[model samples]
Target: MANNNSTDKQGGIKNNNLNKTEEEDEKKKNKKIFIVIGVAVGVVIIIIILILLLFTFCRRGSAGETEATGVEMTEVMEGSEETETLEDTSGASGETSSETEESTEETTAEETTGEEETTETEETTADEEAIAPTITLATYMGPVYSSADGVCYYRVQANVTGTPAPTIVWSRNDGSGLGPNRAQVNLHSPSETYTLTATATNSAGSDTESITLSWGCNRPPTVHEITLMGDHIAGVDYTVSAYATDPDGDTLTYQWSASGGSIANPNINPK
Candidate 1:
């Protein structure tokens, strides 16, 4: 019986040792699982903190850019207002200068117009004064021979001056009619004497001038011969000539009378 009790006690001790070894292995496994969970949680917390810092940095940058843009806009607005104010002031000054220039030009134009009117009035007043007419007679020969009518004539002319234009009238002492400002007398004999008078009349005054004229003797012209040339047929042309001379060295004129046909160039000496 003693030997059997001792074997039983040894068996109990071996079982107790095996149970403690198993319990220690279980505790080791639990500790390994807790360490793995703690490491995973720490990695997740670090990732979340990095994301918050990035978001804060981005917000600060955006705010700074917005403030800089606002400042630039304010500066641009101030510059625009200054430019507009300066332009308005310059425009007002220019208007004032233009008004002054216009006033000066108008005053000068009025003064010039007044001077021209004064000059015209003075000239008109000077023209209103009156002066009497003065008469002057032109010198002429006593007798002159007319070749066209074969007659002798005495002629005189007068010149007159006055403020207004004068009308001249001529008269002869022998009760003969006369031309304007001139007297022409036809002579039938060489012993004739004539008194010529010129009278100038105007609105201002009147004047008279007188002259005396006498005629000298002139000799008559004598014809030497007359000749006719060319065919005397009715439809043909013929030329006629007259040979004549004067004793007093006067120019002689010829006249032709035709009973039939025609005469060409009647005023010429050769016909």
Candidate 2:
């Protein structure tokens, strides 16, 4: 590359002092510019190498400086282009090998700093994932009723489900744990039997479901109809039976009473 040019060439456009055509001059200028850039890259590489070498050999400091100066000269080869783009133009005077060491140190420092920044970025991303939406229980508990006092309250559990579960809120007008599931409906008032409902939620979403219960408590028996065994004999003893029902099956007992009515035969009364 250095051989391509002659000292007598005007403006250093080509090998000879002979005047070239306008096209030829333009092409030559472009070629030189490219060559200058390549040389600049090489100088930069040399600076890096010199810096590494200097770390071990003190004498190489001057060698590194010289390489760096060459890089500066190559850069100046394109100096008239722009000033800001030519930041390291100082390389011309920094020809001492010491400049090479500085270049390498700068690269090392940039690498270290970049690595730490990358690590911090990864940690921050992980933290964001850790704090992802959480499912919270907005409200959860069983509802109670007067009959439920002695029996298990058919608590229709309520909850919220979404990213970040909401807080659970509940109230029982009966001052009992027996409240409607979130809807504030009074259960067990009209419906002798009711199904409990519940909701699950998170900050992002919510879902609901029914809660099951097995109520086995006895309820006051309701008398529906009465039946007699059979037509009774004038003086015979017979049994009169009663039919009753309760939500829960409970054994029933019987007692006989009379009002104005008496035993069919007072004289035949056994007890």
Candidate 3:
């Protein structure tokens, strides 16, 4: 009976030691989990702070650009105001000079005697018999080929008549007057057309006539091939080459365009 009691006591002590070890292991596992959770939370907080800082920096940059643009606009507005003020002052001065000239003319007319007025009336009545001006544009004989200094042009002429020999003026394509009765039009393409105008003015009246001229005398340029060199990447420049020939040996002008992005020089070849 005594031996049995001693064995039972030894077994009880072993069970207590096992239970203490299990509790210690559980505590260590819980501590490890807490450490992992804390690290994850700290990382998340740092990421949020970095994002906020980046956003703030971007906003500041945009605001700075806006301020700079506003400053430029203000400067332009001030310059325009100054220009307007100067123009107003100049216009006022011109009006004053014109008024003074008119006053002087009125005084001179008032000083004229009754006999001079009667003589002026007689001269005006004599001039009233003059006929009105007339303009006649010659039939377009197509574009006349003319080359001077390696430049091609189309020459045109017209006729005018008046009682007192009216002044004649010629204009082409709605541009400024070229001269008396002749005008020149620049040759743009084989299928292009030009409008030539003639105006005659006299004391009696004024007359105008217009004629259309189709240019098909010269051959147009032909484009053979267009090639691109280098990689097409954003923010990087690439070279574009075009092979073209003009049959008439005329000077060729190259114009380039793109659907997107920007070109350094659109008019230059190999852009």
Give all TM-scores, in the order shown. 0.32, 0.27, 0.33
lDDT of 3 by residue, 1-271 (tens): 9999999999999999999999999999999999999999999999999999999999999999999999999999999999998888787998878888999998887778666988999988868877799888774334445444332356566677788878877675322374567666666655667777878898888999987766556656889998878887888888889999987689899988889888789899642
State, as a TM-score between 0 and 1, how close model 3 is to the true structure: 0.33
Q: Relative to the unseen true structure, what is the C-alpha lDDT of residue 212 in candidate 3, on a scale of 0 to 100?
A: 71
RMSD of each: 32.9, 27.9, 34.1
Q: How do the residues 1-271 of candidate 2 rate in per-residue lDDT, one tens digit apiece?
A: 5544544354565533445576688999999999999999999999999998878687677789999999999888767566644555555646645777899999999999999999999988765544233322222434433454444343244533333434444333233544333533234433344444544444434454553344433456677765567786766666655666655566655455656445454333122
> Where does candidate 1 stray beyond 4 Å?
1-128, 140-142, 147-150, 172-179, 221-271
Reference-based lDDT, residue 63, model 2: 85
* Pairs of residues clashing in candidate 3: none
How do the residues 220-259 of candidate 1 rate in per-residue lDDT, one tens digit apiece? 7888888888767878888788888886689777777788
List per-prediction Cα lDDT, in the order shown.
0.78, 0.55, 0.78
Ten contiguous residues with the weakest lDDT in model 2: 130-139
Rank candidates, TM-score, best first: 3, 1, 2
- Superpose all Cα atoms of candidate 2 onto the true structure and report the RMSD in Å to 1 decimal: 27.9
The deviation in Å at residue 48 for candidate 2 is 66
| Candidate 3 backbone overlaps, count | 0
Show model 3 residue runs off by greater than 4 Å. Answer: 1-124, 139-142, 145-152, 173-179, 220-271
